[model samples]
Target: MGSCEVYPQTIQHSPNGRFVVVCGDGEYIIYTAMALRNKSYGSAQEFVWAHDSSQYAIREGNSVVKIFKNFKEKKTFKPGFGADCIFGGFLLGVRSNSGLAFYGWETSDLIRRVEILPKHIFWSDSGELVCIATEESFFVLRFLMERVTTAQESREMLTEDGIEDAFEVLGEVQEVVKTGLWVGDCFIYTSSVNRLNYYVGGEIITIAHLDRTMYLLGYIPKDDRLYLGDKELNIISYSLLLSVLEYETAVMRKDFNTADRVLPTIPLEQRTRPLSVMLFKNNCLISVLLNYLTRLSILLQFSGEQIV
Candidate 1:
């Protein structure tokens, strides 16, 4: 509804939606998104927001990196040698020669290092897990943020190696993840094959194969739906559930104990799709037939016709 003093080349809103930034002509302004007041300003070649959106980084003067907390400059330093890219979040991430290395925002000390080729990094809303999308695949990791942050704040003793203990790479999925979002322990992504899938505990299960490129925008737990935007900018949504995701993951892993336990706990109406997904997985002919029968029974139950 208004114009800016400087025409913006790019505009980005924080993940938290509290702040908005506009960059143009090597200068930037951070504004309170609602009231549109300029709270922070600086000159930098690049501007990147952190995971929580409370902090951000700006690259200026060659290798120099600056971090701003709550719209105020907090720290400035140089990324270590072999580091090529900067990603600010729960930690200051730099792509190094071997892998990704994280540093504390205040002390700039090494928090942990991960060995992987990362093209994009997505941290979960809860900040407990992170998904690193590589050239051809994607992987997840458990970041011990509390532990690492405590070590930084208390200056506690670390092992001689000092890292290795702070993070664990869960595993990688070779699916070409185009774009995705994380909800709790599940990662919902659209693949290169035009399929929507969710990953959990190293296994992936298909949700649908709509032949359109979709980007995950948000998930509403109360309504049990995911809002997505397609290439044409049309908004679409689909029903999803966390319990169903967990049950399907357990089933894909062939953990019958877990699958059987979680199956009945799912809302009755949502049970069919989870089982239908398994029918096409790597299961054999006999398993497929059995799953087929199970689907029929679920349908009958849905129609209020009990299976005799």
Candidate 2:
């Protein structure tokens, strides 16, 4: 299928590569890759595909971001101003003029907000890291999920005061960086002149300079590869050094669920790192303790007994 529009502003393949999304002429089109059959979804200023490609979201106008599941409109909410919104795993990132806000895609719950407008934003495939670039610096934010016992508690947690208890800034680079992607603990990005650079362990390393300007399109954590698009419309993939940093970071933050999801992606040898092993054991112990405490508290409450 084809559109009568002169050209499409952007074209993207779903994570599973089963479908293609084309945006142009104020419409977003979805096409099946095999037969090339297509459908238009009307007007959208911007759109983003979920990491698994099971759903997608579109920035409608300036204030609202609408999510679609199974190609149907699922939910809509105001994520402040600006049309920059992205999704990875269960988290959604939106850029407002005031700051960058992260939300739980399923619940529409605000997770955290950073008081800065980033030039570029990228969420790690596992949703453990959020890497952002600004004119003067680069930053990474990390978060953990906690079990909330009540709807009231969850509501309180979404408030600005409680957001600090859920997320933290992992690191920042005091240098001007362009498009970037997070790979484990390292951040790979390009400079204004299209110079490839990597930041790890507080050090920035320049890798190479490309002949033409390029933008980071996406990253495949499973394959440890980055997809880049250049001005000439050429797309290229480059292999990157894989690390278990995402898993370790998640475990360190006590986000076992996310860590568990990332664990299988890591090489077995890397999984045995001392910190990883220790954190795993500690997390298990904490889980058991919390469970016991919860049960004891409930029993006491039901028995109407007072503790000394």
Candidate 3:
């Protein structure tokens, strides 16, 4: 195996397991774990792997973060006063000294900023919720990207002519619980010092209290279980059916936006099943039909259509 002499303080493997990042020696090094191909960046403080692991950003300074694609630097930006870490998705999550902020990954536009400094930050696999943990509390920030009217459309009355241009909107946040990892729709965490706690549909439940502290490693959607590590270095697994049920209920309630954000996290086999595929397709069709119906109704009313 090919290895570097430097010890890494922060390391992350890409979601696809094709690449790995090592942060140390005042540089960020990226290399394929199974091969010898690698690249490095100097004067970097922190870095984040995109969900697909194909892109990344390195913190060059307190305010500046440089993004890279395919091992090449693409763009740089000064996010704000205290931006430290970067999390990639439809938008970029920049962690600063004051709080977290969102920015357009491509346009380099500032979207929204939240003022909450956290000790630990974990973005769900689906990128739907950002789980932040502090010594005294925990927070879950939910985000959605929707199309909206552009500024140009608002100003050009003559050009508008009943047609409006649209742009992506970074959504708002909702605090679900004091602490925990958001697995699917459920929040899982260690509470009361040593007990495993989870919340589903606004209800809090304690699964067990351990003699020692346990850390949540990650979630496995295929088995609907959580992989955890204990202080003594023991690994444990726990089921979260309630959380899965919560997600399904959201879909049944026609909360397709949330459902769409979470759909990527489901197992591929399940997502490809005939019934699952049909359900998702139907959801999309319903949204399109409803939108056209709304436009048709408005047009008919303005055209003076008569009721029979």
Cα lDDT of all candidates, in order? 0.73, 0.66, 0.60
Q: Candidate 2 — which pairs collide?
A: none
Candidate 1 residue lDDT tens string, 1-308: 34565668778899889888887787888888988887788897667788778789887754777888877888888865455666755667777566877777667777776666677777777777888888899888888866775765666646433465577789888888887888767888888888888887665768788767888788898888888887788998888876777666665556666665665557666756555655455462244336435855786668675432
Q: Which runs of model 2 end up more than 4 angstroms from their true locations?
A: 1-6, 80-90, 147-156, 160-162, 215-229, 233-308
Q: Could you give candidate 3's per-residue lDDT for residues 1-308 as a string of tens digits? A: 87765688988777788877888876777777788477555568788866666677788767788877777888988875567666655456787777766665555556566565665665665665566665566665555433222432344421212112222222222332333566665567776467777644334456676777677787776677777786689999876543344545455446766655554344433433332433454464455235434544675677574322
Task: Judge candidate 3 at residue 294 and give its lDDT.
Answer: 58
* Cα error of candidate 1 at position 85, Å: 2.5
Poorest lDDT segment (10 consecutive residues) of candidate 3: 160-169
Give the TM-scores of the predictions, in the order they appear: 0.76, 0.66, 0.65
Off by over 4 Å in 1: 4-10, 96-98, 146-162, 246-265, 272-308
**lDDT-based ranking:** 1, 2, 3
